[model samples]
Target chain A: MTGIEPLAVAAAGLMGIGLYGFCLCRHAVRRLLSINLFGNGVFLALILIARRLPDGPDPVPHAMVLTGIVIAVSATAFGLALVRRQARTRGDDET
Target chain B: MTALDSLLALLLLLLAARCVSARSLLQAIVAFIVLGLLLALSWVRLEAPDLALAEAAIGAGLLGVLLLGTWRSLPLGHGNERIPLPWQGLRPALITTGCTVLAVLLTVALHQHPEQAAMSGLAALDQLDAAGVDQPVTAVLLNFRAYDTLLEMGVLLMALIGTLMLDSPLPRDTELPARTMLPATLAQLFLPLILLIGLYLVWAGAYSPGGAFQGGAVLAGAGVLLILTGFGEGDGRDGWVLRALLAGGALVFTLAGLLLIPVTGAFMAYPQGLVTPIMVLIEFSLALSIALSLLLLYTGTPGLRRRGER
Candidate 1:
């Protein structure tokens, strides 16, 4: 173990806030936003951990994070579509 | 540098809190977008520029557009009602306490930095020449861990398919709304430049932070700009060409990996003499598919058409 990094502390804070938001927010879209915030925290944590290596940042984790971002974005987009469908089904399509 | 990192860390926490606690969805959306950009900055500080690029493009940029569009499509006051806590009385407090405990545990767990943990990165770097890519991250993605990337493309495709099943296209606009000259002019001026940059990014990924994901997201942004500016619009009719392009990346990736097994005696291992060209082919095809899939997801449609086309 080494001295705690500030970014690690921030990552924890993000995860906490995201979890709180996800639980408290009633709107499906807001909940999605919260989940994404949580995902961001996890990504940040991984990136920070990758920095722990002596010579350079770990490319394996970097590649993983890249893949994770794409997956997150795609999943979020799909979730958004579902939200739109739900609203339309509820007769709230007044856009 | 430590001070700057501390400031960024503080900013990230504050922004995430604000994003979650804002009264209005619009405010929360804006806060989330800013948080995403700040996260990208933090990645750069952490020495992961490839992740930073992907985050900035897909995580912040494209996701922002999708969020805003969804917000616009939802009826006014539809989801803006009172946001009560998940439960009454002590449950909210209990949840908050639980989250805090979880955070603490995660932080404590993350502090351990064993010297042996560096072996994977060191091994990747040691064999970078044999991997056929200059950038270690690219090598890890397109070569060393090509299987993971291949399956990721499948996940992306499946997501697109699921979205399409919803049968709800985003509000289609055949032309730009009145009095929006600036967006139209900007799209016209920037479309070519954006296209060029996106392609350049794909080529540069062989030796840089840019790659299929980032490059594809940028190209998707270009498509979004066109759609928003009335140059192109989502069409309900499905076309073979669009379908092929949408599935091209995963198709090429699978074929490349499978076809190479006989030549290299292992799945996804490129022949020594043809590694670069094969990677370039796989990279470009993947970019094309990713870009089209994302664009379609944004459109919520099966096809896209020029504004005036039948």
Candidate 2:
């Protein structure tokens, strides 16, 4: 009923959508995109929760999310590298 | 619910769904970028300006560039075969249904427990004076849980090493045709602008939402642009200075933390009045290291060299 509640619901919905895509998508690139969407959904929920604080926005969750963002990017970069190597190897084998 | 919040939330949900459902990988990547921007807006609405800036820079800007670059480098139109299985659709439906139910239950429980106070939040807030920084998020990062940051830097280094080890030997240099998509004049005009913005974000991070990660990502984007436009090549080997730049952050942070043992009697503890300066130094070094690391990752190489150079 509140403003925050709707955002939470929307984030939940996004998470569900992301989960479905991750499960169904066979392409590594598409799966990467799905994983990021899933991450963004979780971040939305965390940020919304941070807004519920009274005096000032909660810094702890903000910090946690910042760390999460960097870690997510790192993991995605690693995954992308893996995908590229796999593709290159597959191409080489076919040749 | 406020009209604006509802609108933003709806926009985010739509973009997120589209990102997953788009048939073309390129279109899906673009949609994912839009979703990241909307998520940044959502973070801003949540009163987390720091996270908003980070999401905009790293999440949308850098990640978008990385995805596009990777998409370009791969053999095109090769991986979109739809699987033929009788239970394919049913499996996803069941999984999503279960996840949705669990998420809803968790959200309900969290909402009901609104009165619970976060102890870590309280502790960090209480120790603001000792942190020598006015920003609580920065304090939390560089002071309260600095050990986590240290380990994270290690993980990034390991990933870079792994990528280098896995990369195939460089192809022979051929006179490749120039890319017409990005004009030289346009690139020259935009390069300085991107550099300025990256520096601004890094410098502004002390009191605001901008920080090393976002700034580093933006810097890496600039590096990626240079490589794409032929100003630099995505060579897999780096010279000594480049290696130093890549290792500087972790090196400085680790050494600083180690040096504190004698003066402050604990690891990673800055002297009573030196926290801000120390944190800033560490952050600057981190920004540079992270930028270089991500750029190298995009290149899928251990090092970068100028075109035509061995």
Candidate 3:
């Protein structure tokens, strides 16, 4: 097998780990981390697959992964905001 | 080449597993950040320097800062658990078994499948001259598949707005203690240099493996440094300038696409010779917006006033 296959497999392993963590993790922050990990796996797969080109790696997936990284951060920020507010509310209610 | 690839693949897997399985949240987050850096390295290995820049900057740098900030904001004891999977005895076993089977099957299929497909950017690259950018990724992002970039800017803007609306972010200025973490001397020395590099990255983007996102992330790192050092004027609440900066990318891309639609005969298509300047303008605005938007996300506030300011 070529070098690319191992990277792909690692990425796939990350996806499985993310899936397990996302479902099982008790902490909201951990869940978010898992989600981001899963997203990273998908992005990595897209990128590694782009290596099949001859002239150079394909630019399309590179661009898409760039966009994906930015979008992933945005989603993470939003989710963190939601989690922060929820945690605050929960703290307040307990008091 | 194969050795390096194998090493990266192994390191990524191990770091990722540690990130997922670390006993504490802090360790997990640290591991995740390291994983991001390693992933950036893998992106480089894949021969995409543009992505490497972005992954290292936005993915590892900016995102790491944000996650750490989030960790700080959460109430104590909430994020510290090693929390097990929600599954009881049989369920965990079932999941492991299922995942292993699927993974094995997929790996086999991937090995057997032929590599022929129509997914390469070669066809689009043949038209790169018309795309108005010298870098293939930039050409693809700013011209060929520009709609995605435009909408991504929209997503960023929405994120900022949503974060602002969530709650009062950051401790009230008066409540914030002076000298949070980084020393003043360090910030004074490094901030300017960071900003210079950020600008250089943006400028180099046209013909090189740098661009708006990577440059924006570098600038956001600068902003994060300023905020941590307690000297930043990130307060965006009333500053129309800040508001404008936050919205600039989407506004520029949409307006350019709309106003030129009739002239260019297609939305976002630059005219015969105007593509260069237009793309530059769009990218400049986009970078600035991304920087500000990311900083806002990091601070989780619509505005940040100086501690002593009224």
Candidate 4:
């Protein structure tokens, strides 16, 4: 209700939801989605936590998240490519 | 928190949940794109404009197209098909419970981490002048921890290589979409502006809320739009030039680092007086490489030649 609890709570909730979805999803593409959700959740937590500190904010974590975002997308693209290859080779629908 | 923050947070949570739980894959994919946009807004609220820009351009724009394109390439009706529900048992319930508990515990712990200890990154901000970039994040990324940035570029190249290795060639759907006058006209007008903006973002990164990642994403978005609208086409052929752009960032950074060793003693030290020019060169190459890699990745091909009879 006060300070930055709401933001933190939202981040924590997203993380939990993403983790739950990661566990529940059966499809590779869906799993990639879940994992990215989880990553954004962590990014949200990190950026906000950096703000909570007395000093203005931390550039290191900010930089990390920035780097992480790009890397996450690249990895996602690659994973999707793999999934497509598997589907082609197996001659079956994605599970 | 202001009402706006609360509202944004609620919207984000809802979209995230929707993306995760939607009954259809297409529905989930759409929700994911919206979630990404909302995340950009959230980043803005958190006072991180750089992040907001990157999230909007890369997270929402490029990634959204990537997801939808993948879905389109998949067999029709795959998105609508209903697969079996979560693992048929107690595992689902247990995972939900476990994650929930973990979340609660971490939230409680977040309150206890010492505030001043988090000052190290901010403290490093004091030494930003030597980095030759006015932006603190830029300094950290390009100077203080250039090694990490170099490795990050390597990760991107690795991903590109991995995608290429597992590349599944599209079924020769070379037919361009019927060219509509309005969108085509608009794209012709917009492409130049987007290209200008991407370059501007990279240039402004030294002193403001823009950088190579954000700029490259914007450039890639432009390329994606071009491919999607049939204003441009992807030849999907391999060549040395495409490979160079794909590996250029990592190669330039690594080679520069090694070359500087005898002069600066430290691996990634930008040397003493030549920091500015070197940083500029590195940023330019990195931006160029990132743009090409992202664009190629979206094209879902190892190489992209502008569409032609060749």
| Candidate closest to the true structure, highest DockQ | 1
Question: What lDDT would each prediction earn against the true structure?
Answer: 0.87, 0.77, 0.81, 0.79
Kindly list the per-residue Cα lDDT of model 3 for residues B246-295, writing each as its tens digit.
88888999999999989989878889889899999989999999998998
RMSD to the true structure for each prediction, in A, is 2.2, 2.9, 2.4, 2.6
**How far is B53's C-alpha from truth in model 3 (Å)?**
1.4
Candidate 2 chain A: worst-modelled 10 consecutive residues by lDDT = A1-10
Question: What CA RMSD would candidate 2 show?
Answer: 2.9
Instruction: After superposing candidate 1 on the true structure, give the runs of residues whose Cα lies further than 4 Å from its correct spot.
Output: A92-95, B81-88, B172-175, B178-180
Query: Over the stretch A8-93, how does candidate 1's per-residue lDDT look in tens digits?
Result: 98888888888988888889989999999999988998888788677888888888888998899999999999999998888754
Off by over 4 Å in 3: A1-4, B83-88, B109-120, B168-182, B233-236
The better-scoring model by TM-score among 1 and 3 is 1
Q: Assess every candidate by TM-score.
A: 0.95, 0.90, 0.93, 0.93
Better of 2 and 3 by TM-score: 3
- 1 against 3, candidate with superior lDDT: 1
Per-residue lDDT, model 3, residue A79, is 85
Q: lDDT tens string, model 3, A5-69? A: 78777777777777777766778888889888888888888787676667777788888899999
Model 4 docking tier (incorrect/acceptable/medium/high): medium
Candidate 4 on A1-95: residue-level lDDT in tens?
23556667677778887887777777777888888888888888878866764555678888988999999999998887777777676665534
Give the Å shift of residue B201 in candidate 2.
2.3
Shift in Å, residue A82, candidate 3: 1.2
